[model samples]
Target: MGGQDRESDAWVYVVNSGVLLDDAFASLTLKRKLERGRVSPENLPPSIVGRVAKADGPTVEAALEAAAAAAPVWGAYPLETRLDKVGELLCRRLTERAEEITRILVAEGHPVVLARWQVSGMLECFGPESLGFYRSQMHQEFRHGERRIQVRRCPDGVVCVNPPQNAPLSSALLGVTSIMAGNALVVRAPRSAPLGVMYVLHEVVRPVLEEVGAPPGTLNVVCGDPVPLLSAWVESPHVDDIMYFGSSENGVRFQERCLTAGKKPILELAGNDVVVVWKDADPELAAEALTESFYGSGQLCMIPNQVVVHPDIADALIASLVRQVGHIRPGRPEEEDVLLTPVLRNEKFFGCLRDALDKGAELACGGHAMQADESRDTAGIFLEPTVVVVRGLEGARDIDAVRHETFFPLLPLIVAERAPDEVLLERFVAYVNSNEYGLRNSVWATSSTVVDTFLSQVRSGGLLKINDSHIGFLPYLPTHGGTGLTGGVFGEANYPILRTSHLQGVSISPGSRPREAVFGAWNALLPTKVPTAFPTTFPTKRSQEF
Candidate 1:
């Protein structure tokens, strides 16, 4: 809150140094471009998203210089010391500032409950259990007979993190795990929702960094368009890695740039996740799982964007889903009872709906655009929870409603009614595997054989769930990142501590003698007579069987 004026909704830069800039050259004024509700688009409110100091050439140069100067020293610290100091500090600060952070998120149009959940999730991610889990990956060794081999994890110089606008704080925290492995960081808070993330970094993390005597550039925060800084990073030789979260197209192109510049890129791209319901799955549970499509108004990457159900159970599942979704009503973000809020992409959403309807897809429920309830101060931007039914993947493959990622409260159901059970299963598996996005996928099935087959056959999603909640966070598990359109060539379950670090193998012996020399006799074979030159003579007798 350094440069923030509540009356004008103006906020100052929240940098690692905790100093506010007064000069125009050092600051960038960011106005609220998109807001909740569909009222008065022309006369936008005077809310300031943020007024941050730009990370220009000179500023970024100094930051990279400091980080480069601090890398060796920070990396040399004992792993346990870094873990104890940084992990405990993060947990304490997040808990102490939970209410303040949650309020900021809610004010930014996040449902009150969802905001609380996000805050709590961030806290939990930095908790003791998560720390311990990551610590376990630092340095591991195993003894074999008379020798011991060790696998040591080391930081990859400097990492630049670019968090997405949708979940800035959570994304930044994910990158913070790099510190546990002793890597220096430069984090970019999302411009649209920078306050919560920026506040946490400045108010909570910065003080602790000073207390622990962390190097000046061990952590840096910037708020502005990432394009220029990304270009700078691509050209900078000091930067070693990048943690990027963005659209599939942009992420793929950025990854290419990183590769060209000889830098490592960890990507978390767009997701069009799916939930497959087999004929034998529990109808009630399947319906409940499908409800996740509307959670956070279907804005999350992990939520199921489409449902593929066996025709035998399609009617029952659809009925259950319709009933469950009917209970969800869009309410004001600040209200405690609110379950959903308005998203700003009105044109894209309406276009997708129109395309779906025109393509012969039937709207099962909640088809019309939501009308604002002026009495309740609700903006008409909120989309009614909608369910569209398609015959199968082919029916919607060419339609935007299914092909592209629709980050709104729209769920499309694909009924695979093609043929015999085996053919249906095979086609369904093929469809899921062929999907470009690979964030997460869920399957509802009672048969162990069916579950096993799906898991073995489908090589699409990063995290596959069997009869469990699709979006639930598992701290110990690698729940972030995906494959294909989700994450590019180097895609894997994202564990920042591991992804930001590299593994080195260490071998130990009791003696100083070279292994080759010590085992020379055992490893070598000699003939009766040594032939210095190539010999033409050879024996052609049958050899004895061993």
Candidate 2:
């Protein structure tokens, strides 16, 4: 009803006072308005707003200055103490506000149930399990002569986080880990998905930041277009590290900018993940796993884009998948198990679907768009759980639909001849290993050997699962990123304790030992220790021995 007028309005949030202010980006309202129905069919949700005032540049600079000034004090905090106070408090607050947060997510187009789970996962990211992971990597000890040397963990100061629009809260969780590692952060949340992030920051993180005596500006969340904020942050000499999530193209560009500015960047970019089903794979299990391949409308970075199935069971697997997919009902955000959000329901996304159909891809099941509710007449961005049987991966011209990360729901199945189980598995492993995107991979196999081979040989993905659950991540697993374009660096496991800090090697010498004492342990184990003395010093002894 208010769609037309709302499309012309924009909301911005900037930091002022000691807390987040709603009118931070008010000036930008004239430049670009926040469109309610422009993306989703919902009304403008309540959130913190920032005004694009020219003088506001100093605010961001001040925030960074505060974070940098506070870094040493925050970084020196005991890991256990920080985990107990800040990490534990954040988790508890999230649990307390779970329902309220889920409703905001639903308002933003995410299904209610899935929204709750998303919050749950965020909470678990700060829980004991994640804390244990940090603890394991925090301290190292080794014996030296009569004393022991200890290696301690250190935090990288002043981290800047730019979360993706698809999963703002979850992506924000990735940034929270920097705090656990004792690094202060400045976060730029997606303008389209600010409500969920604001809710989490206000209800969960703000209190923790205060209670833990975290320095002012240690954790700041600004809501606006990320381009300006990121450019400013990256160019600034104060900002130490930046953690980003977005398209590969943008990621590469961001990396170049950071390098040009002489800054450090950790990018988590796009993915064209693949799933390989061998001849021995069970059809039923493969069907179940297919849900993950298309969940969140296949919008998640780890969601599989292509399925390479053995030709023998390809038909049966497609049939079973079709049946299960049929049960994947699209409904209003209030409905249960309605995972997809009705954003980006435009020609760009649907055009890819149409192009794929025109290119000789056989639709195994869903091919048309569906409405969230018949009465509303306002359609959700729903694409049927499309299963296209292509002769080969090369047959589909809309490869961008399956190859690049399209934040939409589309499933494509590719068939390959069944060969020796070993050879087939090997080929599948090699294909996954060779992929440019390395976020996550799923394999549905009955053979332990097949699973082992995949796990050992598949070098691309950050996480690999066998005959197991997909999409749903545990606290212990690093859920955020991977190698290649996925992050340009390996290891995006969601444990904040690990994500927030860097592995620092510190040697505490009880007494200043000879430099060789550090390398003596290894040298002692060798069959013949390389003589430290120079040839000239041991000339007589060497001559006699020779």
Candidate 3:
């Protein structure tokens, strides 16, 4: 492999007619500059990059043609082969380039720690334990003597992936698992942050694909405006399914379009996740978990958007949270341990705060916007990790912060009204369950009964975190996806390998007679003789059951 700088390499990847197409399709010059080891406001790759992309919106049709030609061949390969190639070989390559990938991610405005966290999450998803679990779920069989019944997940031919701009690299990593599900994939990398993702694909993943003897056009990577690229996928007969990530409002509308075009839509949309703190909860642990709301300046869809605290512990919990918020100051992305990114919607942050304050709410700490170096300023790019205390649940959802998914570092803590344990617990769980959007919900509780109650009743989101890190990734747990607006009609805990595939049942029966098999369920009730021994010929009319 040539040692070309990935940030400046040909960003678009296309192959057609069994031949590679590496020519420049779109010259995306999303250039930035590093000032004193810190990423500047420009974001994305550094100044060395000339053009950012190679593929144009219209050129995506060639990707579809290439993917279609490769789907059957790629899907027919054994699942184990696919897993070994991606889960092992590709995993190794990524590990070798972990430092590089993290640098690129950090340069693209992801904080250093968050960049590493993203890379680690991708690795864990491809780890043996997780891959093994996926293998187990991919197929299951039950045998009855020589006859067998099998339930299995099969790849849905060609799949298209549209990763979100906020987390392009990680989403691209997940999208590649379509190959593990035996699909040929076309990845439409987010134009806002395509370089790092395209770099990983070309440098790490494509090499592994070649090593595994995968056919040409098995995976296509392109970059352009999502509107046209998505339309291209929706209109194409060669495309089978689309795994899309975007805001819930736009995504649900796009889901309708995909359906109208007779294509399956797999959505990863916005999350209005909740965190509940009961009286029996640990304040320190709850504060730490709640800090996830400020990660990536709270633009991340999976992080907690609002909090619900029992009135018994609201004061103490709010104090602890305020102290913790003091430590979450804004800084440049490449700075050590910085979590905040430059938020574009400072007005929305203030708007939510103002609405909350107008409607009987109080700001505990960190409400105003700040600059990259953490100074208070009106026109600063970063919104301080702000926490608003909303007293009581009555009419709380009417507030925009409580009802909607605010893509800022503003957290609304609903202080439950004073009540008995039974009433408070019941209402709190009901509130979380009734949220319009659900990706994740976390609870910090020490009492066994309280924990069990919340777990049993709050059943809307995809994943439930009990006294654990809400944003942390676990080996087998789904790291992305949820129900309601977070995922369209077919949304649940997303394992991309399974999401891009469809379930099918296979049955095998040998040497079975048609008429005998028909009445096999009632064989014991039949007179010990054969049907031929039924006196003379059977009645002219057959039984209604038959």
lDDT of 2 at 446: 74
Error of 1 at 40 (Å): 24
**TM-score, each model?**
0.83, 0.83, 0.88
lDDT by residue (1-546, candidate 2, tens digit) is 000001223444322211111232452342244332233324433442233222145555666776787777778888766666677777788788888887777766677777876887787777788767666777778876666667767787888888887788878876887877788877776765676676676567877877877766567766656777888898887788888888888888888888778777787788777777777788988888777766666777777777888877898888888888766666666678776554334566667777777777777766565565422232444666667787764444346565566656677787865567667766677667777777878887777788788877777766777766666667677776677778765335334445556666656655754755645656678727676423444457777798
Ranking, lDDT, top scorer first: 3, 1, 2
Candidate 1 local lDDT, 220-315, one digit each (tens)? 776656788788777998899999998899999999999999999999988999889999999999998788788777787778898899999999
lDDT of 3 by residue, 1-546 (tens): 111222322343211100111111221221212212233334432233323554654467777888888888888888778876568887788899999998887756678889998998988888878888888888888985466889999999998999988999899888888889988888877756777888898788888888888888888887777787888899899999999899888999999999999898999999999999988888888998898899989988999899999888888889899898877866766677788887765777888889989988888888887776788889777788998889889899989999999988989999998989998888988899899988999998899999989877877988999999998998988889899999988889889898888899987988665665565545646646445222333555664335
lDDT of each: 0.75, 0.68, 0.80
**Clash pairs for candidate 1:** none
- Regions of candidate 2 where Cα sits further than 4 Å from its true position: 1-55, 374-381, 393-398, 489-500, 512-519, 522-546
Model 1: lDDT equals 0.75
The regions of model 1 sitting more than 4 angstroms off are 1-55, 144-147, 372-379, 515-546
lDDT of 2 at 88: 77
